[model samples]
Target: MEIILVPAFADNYLYVLRDPASGKVAAVDPGDAAPLMAELERRGWGLDLILLTHHHNDHTGGVAALVERYAPLVVGAGHDSHRLPPLGRAVADGDRVAFGGTSAEVIATPGHTLGHIAYWFAQDEALFCADTLFALGCGRLFEGTPGQMWESLLRLRALPDATRVCCAHEYTLSNARFAVTVDPDNAALRARAEEIAARRARHEPTVPTLLGVEKATNPFLRADDPGVAAAVGLVGSSPDRVFAELRARKDRF
Candidate 1:
């Protein structure tokens, strides 16, 4: 499987997943059709499927246009049918959908949106997690509570350490800054912050981050850690409470 990152409006990222063996391709959250269509034409690839993680405009804005152009099978959360574009296959948690020679396990990750979902291609060791997860942070709880978001994050935390996280935006640099402010004593986070600065300076992407790296450095995923809990003034609190405090502080930051 080959993954192509297509930058969309501002920091949004649209992805193209291609199966080299079958030459079949799928678009994941196309924010715009022009760039994606151009990329497909450049690579001489035909779109076969459209996978949506959530109903956010930045994620699904180009769906109608692409559907008209490629006539690909659209797949999205059945629970969010009213909000999503027409879905050929409306899936829920644990549903496995085949693409080319492999299949992706659908994980219902509801936090960014009530019907948000992620695609885990185990064979490819890739997690196409839209706004639910980010490079150095997690998504804002716009439609869900802090508890729901925290639980959703815990689910993602259980994935293999080496799994590559394909998040949907370029928010790493700012997230890193916020992370260092909250976890100032964390050497790993400090190192990562510096690296993020350098990468952004070069106009390079810091995505597709290793889950292990996030586990060690991301404060949002480390709410259970004593250091992180104390840093956020939730020393004796439960992981959920710590996470809530962290999220609140991030909202103000």
Candidate 2:
């Protein structure tokens, strides 16, 4: 399986997942259909599936067009039927959908939206986490409370450390800036920020970061770090409060 990241509108990403054996592709959260259509045409592969993580316009707006052009199967939230603009299958958490002769497990992670889900390809160790997890920061609390978001992140953290996280947006640089503010003494983050900046300077994509590396360098994953707790001034009793304080500081930082 090859994961192709198509940088779409603004910071959004539409990922094209390919299975070499079948010569078929599946895309996650296609904001618009033209670019993905062109790529599929270039690769001489037919789109076999459309996996929607949520009902946000940016994530599902292109569903109708793609369905018209390629007639791919659409999978999405069961609670999001009306707004999905012609969904083929209303899926819920734990639903497994097959694509290009393989399968992706649907992980119900509701924080960015009430019915948000992330697709995990355990075989490939890849996750198309639309807006639930970012490079350094998590998605905003548009539909759920901070605590709910916290719980969702914890679930994600439980995945294997080798998992290659394929988040939906390119907010790494800006997120790194705030991460530094949360833990000014973090040498690891500073080095990583520089590396990420250099990668951006060369017009490269800083994706597929391992979960273990994020645990070491990303403040959003290290709310219990001494430096992070000190920087945020959280003298709490539980991990949740420390996480809560870090999130609040990030919101205003």
Candidate 3:
């Protein structure tokens, strides 16, 4: 599979995945059709599938346009089907949807939004976790509780270390800034922060971050760790409580 990254709407990222064998193409969280169309035209590829993570406009705004053009099969969470654009197929957690000659496992992640779902294409090692998980920070509790988000993160954290976390935004630098405040003494985090700063200075994307790197440096993913618990002033508290405090502080950060 070949994956292409297209930037849109200031910080949002749109992904185009293609299967080398069959030349089938799929778009994930297109957000905007202009850039995605341009890229497809550039490559002379046709869209065959559209995978939506949530109902957020920034993620699904281009669905109508893209569908009108390509008539791609639209897939999204059945749990939030009403809010999303008309879905050709409404999937649930653990459901597998085929695309580009392969399939993606739908992961129900309901913190950023009650019906948010990520697509993990195991064969391609890509996890399209739109807003539920970021490089150093997780999504805000827009429509769900901290516990829900924490559980969502835990499920994501259990994936293989080499899995590429293809989250949909360019919020890594800002997230890194807040992460250091909570995991101050973490050498790996500090080093990664410095690296992120350098990458941003060069206007490079820091996304598609490795799950292994995130486990080592991302504080939100480390809410249960002793150092992270103490940093949030929630030592001895349950992981969910510690996670809640960390999230609250981050919201203010």
Candidate 4:
């Protein structure tokens, strides 16, 4: 399995998952269709599926166009049908989607949006986590509460440490800065911050971050850590409260 990142409209990203042996491809959150179409044409690959993680325009805007062009099978969360592009298969948690000889398990992640879901390809150790988890940060609480997002993060964190997290936007540098503000004492975070700065300086993308690295450096995921709790003046607080406080600070940051 090969994953190709397609940058679109400002910081958003659309991913193409390809099966090298079969030349079949699947698109994940294609916010724009032109780039994806161009790439597919360039590679001489046929689109077999379109996987949607949420109903947000930036994530599903290109669905209609792609469908018109390729007539691919579309899959999305059932509860979000009103907002999402027409789905051939409406899925919920525990549902599996197979394409190009690879399969992904749907994970209900409802913080960014109530019906948001993530696609976890266990065999590839890759997660198409739309806007739920970012590098050193998590998505804004638009529709769900901080507790729901926290639970979702915990579920994702439980995956293998080496799992590659493919987030939908390029928010790593700003997120790293905010993380340092709250986790100033973490040497690991400081080092990661520097690395992020250097990568941005070179105009590089800091995505597909390893889950282990996020566990160590992402403040949102470290709500239970002593340093993070103390920094947010929530010592002895539950992880949910700590997470809420951190998210609130980030909203204002």
TM-score of each candidate structure, all chains considered together: 0.99, 0.94, 0.99, 0.98
Model 1, span 1-253: residue lDDT tens = 8999999899988999999888889999997999999999999888999999999988899999999988999999999999999999999999998999988999988888889999999999999999998998999988988888888899899999989999999999989999998899999999999999999999999988999999999999998999988888878999989988988888888
Model 2 whole-model lDDT (C-alpha atoms)? 0.83
Point out the worst 10-residue segment of candidate 3 by lDDT: 98-107
The lDDT values for all models are 0.92, 0.83, 0.93, 0.93
Write the residue-wise lDDT of candidate 3 on 112-184 in tens digits: 8999999998998889999999999899899999999999999999999999999999999999999999999
Instruction: Quote the lDDT for 66 in model 1.
Output: 94
Task: List the pairs of residues colliding in candidate 3.
Answer: none
All models, RMSD in angstroms? 0.7, 1.5, 0.7, 0.8
Query: Residues 1-253, candidate 2, lDDT per residue (tens digit)?
Result: 8999888888888899988778778889998888888898898888888999888888887888888888998888888777776778888878888776678888888778888889888888898888988887888778887677778888888889899999988888888888888878878889999998998889788786788778878777776667777787775535667777777777786
Task: Assess the local accuracy of residue 188 in candidate 1 as a C-alpha lDDT between 0 and 100.
Answer: 92
Tens digits of per-residue lDDT for model 4, 42-90? 9888798999999888898889999998999999999898899989999
